[model samples]
Target: MQGINRCPPVKIFVGLLFAFALNVMVFTQIYGQEAVDSNIISYTDKLAYGVDLSTDIDEFIVSGPDTENFHLVTNNDVKLTLRLNYKFLNLSFGFSPGFLSGNDDDELKGDSSFTEYQVNMFPGRFVQNVFFRRMKGFYVENTEDFVPLWQEGTDPYLQFPDLKSIEWGGYTGFVLNEKFSLRSLLNRQEWQLTSSGSFIPALRYNFTKLANTFESGSYGKENQVDLRADLGYYYNYVVSPKVNIAPYARAGIGPKTSKYTLDGVVDKNTYFVSDYGGGLQLGYNTDQLYMGIRGSFNGYTYKDESDNTISNNLWHGLFYIGYRFETPEKLKNLF
Candidate 1:
């Protein structure tokens, strides 16, 4: 009884500590800047209009003692995403809407049930300087999913639930030379999913010049290309997610977050799990807009408390297209 009573206080204390730390960091950055440059180049000065469309298809097969009777269950999913971005005062704001759906079926019978998922995200960013940049951002995501279950001699049914996730983070980047840069991001994500929270810390190296040099100075000519690689850890409730299978095909890694289970028991020991993958990035950027696509392949093994292990693999893709408009101040200069 006493232990239960103590939980609330601990949570409150931690929450307050985090808030204080965030406030301190923000203030320090704001005050540390020497002064606002009158000659600063803002994103509004390079405004371009664009649009992006993307779709992904993934298939997974799960088999084991528990799933053997079901005889090779296969899951297929597809997602479509769209986004828009605008710049003002050297800041950028982006909004993305996505639709996803999938089906699970018996490999032999091919008769299966379907599930649906949807998500929308709005992320806003503030950039301190255009040449050397420090960025801070906040994002909120809303998601909905429908899960279907089937019982023998009974009709298959669906369960629909809506979920929300929020993240606030900042990235600081240093241009090491002209073509290379180092970047780091710290983000906190809270999900309505299972009442879970995750903290992600990532470090990336940017190869910005290699891809940009190849394009011509046309309307859609690419001004910058980033060949980025990152290593990060996901700290989640009761478990830490690991990146095990590193895919090495593209210029950058794709979504680094996933779930892995072994046997029937959830494996909390990092060494006992293999859950890692990498991705590829291809995109074009103009003065006003940036568009890109990322694709990744991931594999992991998970165990239940019952000592059963399940292996899963996923191939996912993301397409981002957006337009950036000039700020009012920059518009004034154009006229």
Candidate 2:
């Protein structure tokens, strides 16, 4: 009787081990099938929409005596970005409208600028981007001077002319890691004022995949933040007489551009004075969609041969709203 009892226990142990091995084999097969199915599905079918708003401020200005001046500027920008993504493939489209204004004290002048920019892009597979931009503004000696430019009888020549531009470009990107992507873009831009075309070559690297953290269930807490840094070389003909090359970094909720000013002075005379500042963007995103705000900073510096510089900065902000829809994946678990 004791031997019989021991035999049943041994048999039961063997049966349990066999069942566990079979489950493991079944799980491996299911995972393999899912991977194959994922490859067969087109990523474009999964598209989502997003909106962003941003605000930014410049830390300081570097200029000459007549050319180097400082003023505070503010910008309000609204953007709608769409994403087409599946598995490892991703594409995006974006549109932004911005308003900028300058605040000035004595010895510094004020200005107002407005711009609208739109872009279409494919991020990973083969990077491509097309953009259109329009800007209009007035450079004023003072607040009183700016009002006259808007008046019909006032001095139109005193104000900066309206500028419009369109650009198209394609680039290839290689992903070095989850946090880095190297890209090079060749672009052609048309400027309305000069009626001239410009070719630009740019190489940039993305340092942080902030959006990925959100997707990975890492930022589930309230007020989660992500920071990304970028370093880039832009050789372009539109902004300056010579190729202006600068390195810039963007750290915040999302991607940003850096601001620079180009100033040229002749014999106590100032010519071609322009201000450019980086942008700030903040947004929240989920698997299905995203929403956010953006702000632009604009400022100007004017210099004379004697080394007198006048600069002013201003602020403007805008609100953005958008949505996205993506193809749903198969649900694996039902409870």
Candidate 3:
């Protein structure tokens, strides 16, 4: 409870929402009337709401010249999300229901919980995302590699019940092509009638901390600050006026500064890390209804002070269905 309590509270999340609202107001005031090719792009004044089902899993791997790989993982459970969009504003809330939280064999894999708050804003050709994530508990995925003659179905894996991780980060980027409609594909606020592609370049940053509840002298804690620049390409193939398929890929290299505390001793080091990912989305859109499915994977790798290489990877898939309706008079008045 103490470890989880160290995370930012609800008030901080509310502050993020306030900041996002300000961005939407300022950006819409400046670009609301900007004209575009209507034949190629179209907008809907209706309000939209949706339900999304998703699964996200993280894997951490550590290896050294004289050591075999050690894999750590958290339970990959289903998350249910409710999303709402009005004009340029979007909001979402997500949670895992007990029934969907998969079997909890805590003795073998330990218990885990994940909490995150994220916001995405689009102002013209610019894209921005800000988020915070906190995760607790993990278990070794490759138990047989360390525990000799371990039975797969009967033996328990090594669990890190006291481990905790927290991250604060975001990304800002620009879309290159004026003919492309990123909003059409991502937010469902605009619909594209023609197939097009764009080159996007983004800057990403993160402040991360990893720690355990064990006493000093052990793997006490590690803090990392990193910044990277990525270039990605996205293309939407308009299979029909109401359907599209999109594929995108990106890669980045960055500088990472890490501080470590072990046995009450502290050490600091810097390294260059590399990141890469790609994803695909298929969607069907109409004036009053929309649905889609998407899958993506991303990862980063770096070498530590002891020459041990550590890598983190995340893979997720999502299915969403949404409805659009006329904006109520009161909602329109607010805008």
Q: How much lDDT does candidate 3 score?
A: 0.82
**TM-score for each candidate, following the candidate numbering:** 0.36, 0.34, 0.91
List model 1 lDDT by residue over 1-63, tens digit each. 011111232344345335534544574566552222232122423344433343333222334
Query: Model 3: residues >4 Å from true position, as ranges?
Result: 1-5, 24-33, 39-44, 101-103, 215-219
Q: C-alpha displacement of 289 in model 3, angstroms? A: 1.5
Candidate 2 achieves a global lDDT of: 0.30
Tens-digit per-residue lDDT, 53-130, candidate 2: 433332223356334233222222223344333322233444334332322211232233323332323333223332
For residues 1-335, what per-residue lDDT tens digits would candidate 3 score against the true structure?
33334865467768977887787678768878455666455544688888989987789999999899999887546777787787656666666554564525666677877777667777777777887887778889999999999987688888887788889898988889988887777777787788899999999999999888663435578899999999999998999999999999999999999998876799999999999999999999888889999999999999987899999998989999999989899989988
lDDT of each: 0.29, 0.30, 0.82
Considering lDDT, which of the candidate structures 2 and 3 is the better prediction for this target? 3
Question: Which candidate comes out best when scored by lDDT?
Answer: 3
Give the TM-score comparing model 3 with the true structure, all chains together.
0.91
Pairwise TM-score winner, candidates 1 and 2: 1
Best by TM-score: 3
Following a full C-alpha superposition, what root-mean-square deviation does model 2 have from the true structure? 26.4
